[model samples]
Target: MKKRIVIFGSFGKVGEAIDRDLKINTNYEIIAPSKYTEEKSKYWSRNNCDYDILNFKEIKKILINLKPNIIINCAAFTNVDLCEEQKAECWKLNTDFVEMLARATAVTNSHLIQFSTDYIFDGLGGPYSEQASPNPINFYGKSKLAAENAIKSIDCKFSIIRTNFLFGYSRIGKKTFVDYVLDNLSQSKPIKVVDSLYSNPILTSDIAKGVRKVIKEAYLGVINFAGNDYVSRYDIAREIAKLQNLDTNLIEKIGINDVEFLANRPIKAGLKNQKALLDLNLKFQNLENSLLEYLTQLKISKESIKEISKNKN
Candidate 1:
């Protein structure tokens, strides 16, 4: 019999990519949970994978019943501002749920795969390594860091993957960095992006594939999985415009503090993929190439029209 894997937040971007990739390439049975209503069920369901509505308590019951050998957690509270406002809830989902999952995984003798973020670092420097000390400037980062610690504190075998600036398809909201910038540019609206903030914009599919590779190789411990290239928010916008044949002049660069934000942001969020590359022997595409592929997949020909059509369809 093939091994069974239980994926949390399987309806989200990375989750969907993982579900699709595994279903097509592996013999492992993938089970996911939906938190939507009946009329909204099709919104969450994709590619005929087994799915059911579940809460945290219900999730535990499902895990016990299924007895999966591997558990990949793609669920997270990623809204930076909301995390600051709902610190307790963020802790509940980001930190507490991880602890619960770790304990359950330990009980079942299952391997755990948890997603983390580069926001754990304060972005003091460029291209941070796995060994860099994390000093998060916001509640969201703190919650994820706490969760990472919780997973490490447990006695179960696990892989903590730290990534940033993710873009991909989802059953949920559709505002990505590329979409936001491209949309603003196409409308001839002057856009201001932080020149200080920097990180690799990782494709959701790449992250899913990296996680799968880690599982297949039976790798353990913390790993930094991200794009091979480092880029600033302003640079990303400029590149998106360039790729889609939009006017790059519309993407005006501004200081980090210039943009009003509810939560504090790190100055540089890029991660070194050497560890992941060495361990998994994985090669990540550069930012330009990755953006091109993403644009092509969405069937975007021009910058201005891409966001509207992509979101609407």
Candidate 2:
């Protein structure tokens, strides 16, 4: 009998990447829920995997019915600014939903894998380790930290993965840093990026690969997973411009405090990946290399021509 795995938020960035890997490489029977109807469920279905519409009650019901061995919770309210304004909704989705998942998985004696963010730390310090205490400066981070604590309090086996600056493909929308830069450059618009804030911008595919490695090795505890390279938003934007042969000078670098954001942001939220590398035996690409690979995968060819055309117009 093969192990059964259920992944929440199957259409999300990291979730989709994990689903793709599970479909192509593994023998585990993967099941995921989507918001779409059965007829329109092609977005979530692939390689004989199961798909269904899921809610809190539905999730609990499914756990009772399927009795999966592992439940990966990828669902969360990740919008930082919006989460600040919508406190109730953010708590409901980010914190409450995770608790519900933990309870359901625990009843089935299943292991839970929950994704968290680097924002759980206030960014006042340098690189954060798994053992570092979290002081969330914003509502989004607070909610995520609450969820992490809830999962930890549960009796079941669980792994809480804290990562930063994620970029990846999904069925819903393109909201990644790489996509944002490419979209702005495609319109020949000057980009303003924060120079002070730094992070390990982990690629979506890399995160998926890391999750698989953790599950395969049965590693337990909080893991700080992120890209090996530490870079700022401005550096990332400049690199994107260089890759597209656009004028790197067009990217205006500004301090984090100068920007008027709706929610507070961390100044240095990069996580050290030494533990992930040593324990999981995983190697991560730098931010520049990851951006280049993302662009190539998206077939953003004729890059110089596209920018020139946009500028000329």
Candidate 3:
């Protein structure tokens, strides 16, 4: 019998990619999205999900019914400024909901894999290894760190994947760094690209591959998985433009502090991929190669749109 896998936040880029990978690999039975729809679920889960993650009772009940051997949680309030302003919601989802999952997983003995971020660090010095001490400067980072702490405290088997700069082409209409660059440049809009903050952003599909390996290996621990290249945010945009042949003139170079933000950001906050490489044996796609793949997807997307339009006419 195949091990049953349940994925939450299946609509997001990471979740969608994982879902597709699992289906393609045919290693596990995947269940995506909570069964409850808007009318059937509660206020919070109304259109979002079927069950409230904070409610241990509901979480427990759901786990008992599903009986999944693996649970991959991709849900989170990721907007830094928004998380700072909405502290209550951020803590509830990022930290509290994860706590409930960790506790519930203890009962079912389900292996939980949770996605995390580089924001857990203060960006003092990086290309940080897995053992680096965490000192989050903002509420979002604090909440994510709290979630990691909660999972660690629990007895359940879990792997909190700490990744950075997630990039990918999405059929689900999720926005990415490439999207931001293309959309702005197409409209002839000038955009500010931060030069100070740096990270080794992993491709979403590559992250999905890493996830598959983790499940196959049954690894239970926190791991830092990201790209091989370490570059600044501004350079990321600059690279995107060069790959897509977009106008480089419109891209502006600015420091981290130049842009006003509600929450503090980490400069030089890139994750070291040595652990993932050694353990998972996953060699990540280089920045240029990954960005180039996005170009191919863009061509297909354009052709698909035109075909649909022609059919309608």
Sorted on lDDT, best first, the list reads 3, 2, 1
Cα displacement (angstroms), candidate 3, residue 299, comes to 2.8
lDDT of 3: 0.84
Q: Is candidate 2 or candidate 3 better by TM-score?
A: 3
lDDT of 2 by residue, 166-252 (tens): 787654564887788888887888888889778988888888888889888887889988887888888888878888888777688
Instruction: List the candidates' TM-scores in order.
Output: 0.90, 0.89, 0.91
Q: Candidate 2 local accuracy as lDDT? A: 0.83
Clashes of 2: 0
Candidate 3 on 1-313: residue-level lDDT in tens? 8899988776677887887788886668777655454433331233424555556677668787888999999988888999988999899889988888898788899999998899999999987899999999999999999999999999999999999888776664789876888899878899998887889977888889899999999988989888888998888888888877889999999877788999999887989998888998989877888777767767888899899899999
Candidate 3, superposed: residue stretches over 4 Å from native: 34-56, 305-313
Candidate models: Cα lDDT each = 0.81, 0.83, 0.84
User: For candidate 1, what is the lDDT?
Assistant: 0.81
Which runs in model 2 stand beyond 4 Å of their true positions?
Answer: 37-42, 45-54, 300-313
Clashes of each: 0, 0, 0
**Can you write out model 1's per-residue Cα lDDT over 47-78, one digit (the tens) per residue?**
43344432557667667777888999988888
